[model samples]
Target: MGIPRTPVRGVAALAALAALSLTVTACASEKATGGGGEASAPSAVGGDGVKTGPGVTADKITIGLMTDLTGPYASFGKSLTQAQQLYFEQANAAGGVCGRQLEALVRDHGYDAQKAVAAYTEIAPKVVALAHVVGSPMVNALKQRIETDQMLTLPQAWATGLLGSRAIQVTGTTYDIDMINGVDFLTREKGLKSGDRIGHLYFEGDYGESALNGSKYASEKLGLTLVEQKIKATDQDMSAQVAAFKAEGVKAVLVSVGPRQTASLVGVSLAKGMDVPFVGSNSAYSPQLLPTPAGPALLKDFYYMTAGTPISSELPALKKLAADYTAKYPDTAIDSGVPAGYSAAAIVVDALKKACEGKDLTRAAVVAAHRGQSAWGEEFGTIMDFTTFDRPASLLSYVAKPDKAALGGAVVFEEATTSDLAREYRVPVG
Candidate 1:
């Protein structure tokens, strides 16, 4: 769980979810190797004399991270991992977690499913759980492996399919609910009539599919005309999809996509003389969007619906965290993914504290503690009742428009919303 001044450079597992290059400094730990070190690590064998889980010794716990640092989503992955590192570093600075230091094993998948699987295979054997991972496609591809191992994971994928995994923990909203509420915001606040045409564009993976489910549900309930198009993760051009929507004469667009495609969609749509509004799901807006050649086009059309507090919220805790994180990283702006990564690590830290109450610190104990929570909220906007795993712990989201001046190029938050209908949907475990 602990390594002293260890530098984990790229080791051929997963890519940073979004950043191009990653730099991490391991926290110092006394039980890093357990050879009569100055700090005492919890013994692998409890007083009961039984062996414990993988990546757990007398004094440390090891966790894994699958990022997309070198891929299309590299910025997201990199930002997430950096924030995670910072969170753990802070925890260590505060005297480690329950007398045990947390160690992170990170790999870059470059957004490739096969690479994700390989990273999981290599890292899983050395860690107690996956603190976070990159893409929905990769998670889906490795579901069986994860289930078979019963390993605890804080997934990067916000898909409904994760609802059934006893080993996974999610407190924030899901993509489907966020998108549903997004459309609801559009209809209620953005001046869209019930029957107005709303075009849709999404990826073919769990993340996009989940968002599509929400948009579809909203469109059906609100009587909006729905025109849908699916894109691949590798796709950089969206002219065809834009053409299709323009041909449909859609009044606006709903995107369950990401920044790269968001830019392409806006540029192509604008170049085609179709300047309709575009509302995106939480993960759609990337910091790079506003700096791109298509930045102005996006500024003219794109808005985002976030599953948690917008990284730009003026809420006291978020504000402090954003300020502190930026101060620490200096060069990086506070983005949506930074707070997300920090909170995800917060949940793990809390659960680990619970598991170590009796000094057991077993993987089973950690997973059980996570699922047994009566109420869980990272004190960000989202809150959860883990009473069951049929749905995300919560389904609250905020609506924000893309602005160049925002710290992360994401600005403006106009009240958060949660759909009542989303609560009625069946979230399946796969």
Candidate 2:
């Protein structure tokens, strides 16, 4: 069954939304720390507190990371590991942070919360803070403990429920905020008029649940009708859900599963003639996931949001980072998680550089520096900001599509559109 299509206009509406987002983010930034701070260029260290070069010396500073190196999100987790190792390795080669070399102690929790807790405690005393943590539950399990102990956590994705906390730095827009922005774009820019039926195909977990809830909240807020489908991360079958969406006549679908599951859902949806465009958070938007058995066929109209520009040759920062990474680790591939891992590491390094201001590199000093500093990095279109109370101030995401021609015959990478709808939702900066 086919549904009535609503004609949408984009050029002007998207531009207006972008301007509005910038203003809102600026107001939030002023509220975050009360004043505009100076913006720094490419150097990792900021101000006088930061030790130049790879300053993570054995006695000075040690960074610990808890990741799912061999679990459900292992693919992304592995890329994160590579990013961290490669970033620190380069930092060390430069000189080190604060004249001290950066040291990263990473452990695998298999994406298990209990195991993550155990690993957190085990790694607690060894490092200054936990940086670039991967999973929602794992981070949730350790949030209180990290806060109580006054440690820094750079969570890769955004969750609004995580706001107003001290121990974390969110990399993207909050789930609620982002959903609202996405809905606004769909309705206003994409002409997804009011009363349009929206669909959700989410995994059955906290991560999925968060996205689902956010989607519902946004839909209801914007007067959009909705259909819901729940799947497990382990589930390989999505025909039933695809059928349901088709029958319900959903105009657009919001998916919250990982890469494999997302591909499966898209595959079934495409094969069954379900042409509804699907939108997803960062988790579902992987270059590696798009080339699986039934990937391209399913993800034809697939669009997902990300917090950064991603690693494209067009972005000089990303280009430099890619060059650095390739020089350091010649065998690895640069996928979705690689840039994120670098950004996450960059956030932590920014904080540490601030924290190390005018003092010997110590955990206490690092924590203090993070608390006292106003913001990190130039919010140059990326969601990297922080304050004393608002740990994760902003998030940035982009819309990307599979590039069959560019990736040779494989079509393993996602090429970004010049104006991604996701950019309209950037949490503004002052």
Candidate 3:
């Protein structure tokens, strides 16, 4: 998953039933009670006058976050998790949804499919909804279970294959959409032209494949040749891939892998003097990489696309978020994940608030509330329309380049905008 930039602004796996041991982290706000020392009465309740369901109680609501920590994407996950915790803390301070304190049940899957399943199975019965689930493979592994429970889940993934599921809401543009816009940027701004060969280095699963689909569509639409190179999440060395692209004489490269792989690819390519421009999906970059050996290489020719505003933006919401987060986590480094996580939690809170209005906090009611949202706006990014599940909430993407001195280590070069080809391209549904 990637962070947001507007003009900035901003998968699946199978189930393995192996014995899994995991730690469940809890982040909750101080409990609040009525003036007379009685637990606050719920603003509304179900028809039976008792509104209760998994993770929802008279005085508290629990939401689950399944993310990657101590894994390849740990940097992204840790920052995202912290931002969500911050949001929940603020919400609780302001009197949580339906007059109940909000609690976040966080479990780290370490980006492993089996661990993700185990974590979900353990937390599913204790949460009203999922605020965030990271990794396309992890989400894909739990897709059927999520649907069966009718749980409203916000995945930190953008693969198009994850679409069409009412229960799984992808918060922003899909990976394909980002790539479509990315390809356009290369042609229109980076000096690539029609008939030029474009190489794509992507992971093998839904994340990469879905992004590849977009590049394929863009190439076909604009008369470019796409050279494909598929890699695994575990693959780090990109020397061979760079050699191949060099041989193919590709003018540009699109990446759909994680930050580590991105570093390797760019660093190796630069070392070999393969100075072509590189664009990546949101998942392909991390602020943590700015200090690494590949930092210079990435800064020179690497760009990424996302659906949210960058943390360095002058947007008021983003500024406030940065200030609050810095105060809360004095020792932590701010990154794109801060906005990404906060935006996601904001969406979940919106749904919960809507559900409260109807006097229902049941899992099904929460889902309904989320589906009712249309043209929902967030200060950190573009407007999102969630009434439908077949396409992205927004199509606009921000093009950004890594900046060593910037907050989140990135600065947007192209504000949020949609390419004509992207607008015309049909989004594939599962």
Candidate 4:
């Protein structure tokens, strides 16, 4: 289960990678034009006769996205995509990025890494960058392509195993760091005491294990007892797991699986008369959880932690996003994932503008612009320089309690916070 982790690139490695991108771009240009001068490279309209990258034409700059539109995490994927699509549309209406309108090319991986990799392969050569890549499992599968292909990806998952590649950009805290802060919040606010029995339900892959490591570390540090169980990301029933936790009389539960698993655990436990708090990791929450039959049950005991501020936040950036979203799609409900998509688009837009400033836009130019950033903000949190191998750019998460009145929306009670354990956390790079 212990695969070697990837290490982050330092300044020298980043420059080397950037140079690789440029070199690949040049080679691709040569190949596409039959040894002609400056062809297949993305070029500016009315300025140059040469193109720079795969998906950039004079009128549009396309971005590729892979997500679970019909799989287990379908709700989050759908909502995230909606936000991204609408945001880009709004941006284009006012003024396009670098004089070219932005376009989103989407593919559904159905939560399967194999399919995700295939989809990525099919679209990798047709876009300037990846606008969104969902799921930790998908990221695990795409690691090599990201590192070698210079296909910059904006990932929704924050597992540490996928953090090493400079091509993949993470916008939030790693699952491990989020859990450390999570446990700290539990101990301080929920009166979770030393020696108390806690249960964790997680998937058996990188994403789940990343969060489990945090809970295990937190238990050792806080003098608490952790009883752990593993499940698959696609698990739909958890009666046995609930029974096991019930038998052990765990005071609270922590989950690192998807929303279906979380719902099953909470619902089954309640039906069995073994009720307890079930705190969820970012991936374990979705707005769809509220309308389910388990909604009432969750209202009694569910809590969630997110690496970014909620879409409902009063911050100006979030306010503009929420306003734009509602104006475009008035009937659609909002969730934490919407802001995530919005922030990622903002970052991509920022980078694209920088990369295209009085120069031809290329994938390498985007990479260089991203690496050159000393400080970056998506209006949700500060992004650390991945070029420096800062594994977790930020080590904080916002904790929220469910609001029954709003159905699925949560009232964020705590701002993103970091504990001493989180600040010093480290994980292996594959």
Model number with the top TM-score: 3
Tens-digit lDDT track for model 3 on 152-258? 99988899988999999997799999999999999889888888999999988788889999999999988999999999877767889999999999999998887
The residue-by-residue lDDT of candidate 1 on 269-324, one tens digit each, is: 88899978888877677766555567788777677776667667677777877877
Q: What is the lDDT of residue 148 in candidate 2?
A: 73
lDDT of 4 by residue, 322-355 (tens): 7788887676667766787877787777778887
Candidates arranged by TM-score, highest first: 3, 1, 4, 2
Give, for candidate 1, the lowest lDDT window spanning 10 residues.
Answer: 1-10
Estimate the TM-score for candidate 1.
0.86
Per-residue lDDT of model 2, residues 80-122, tens digit only = 7667877877778878676667767777776677988888777
Task: Give each model's clash number.
Answer: 29, 26, 21, 10
Tell me which residue pairs clash in candidate 4: 4-430, 5-429, 5-430, 6-429, 6-430, 41-51, 41-52, 42-51, 42-52, 42-53
Best candidate according to lDDT: 3
- Residue 257, model 4: lDDT of 79
lDDT of each: 0.70, 0.59, 0.81, 0.71
Ranking by lDDT: 3, 4, 1, 2
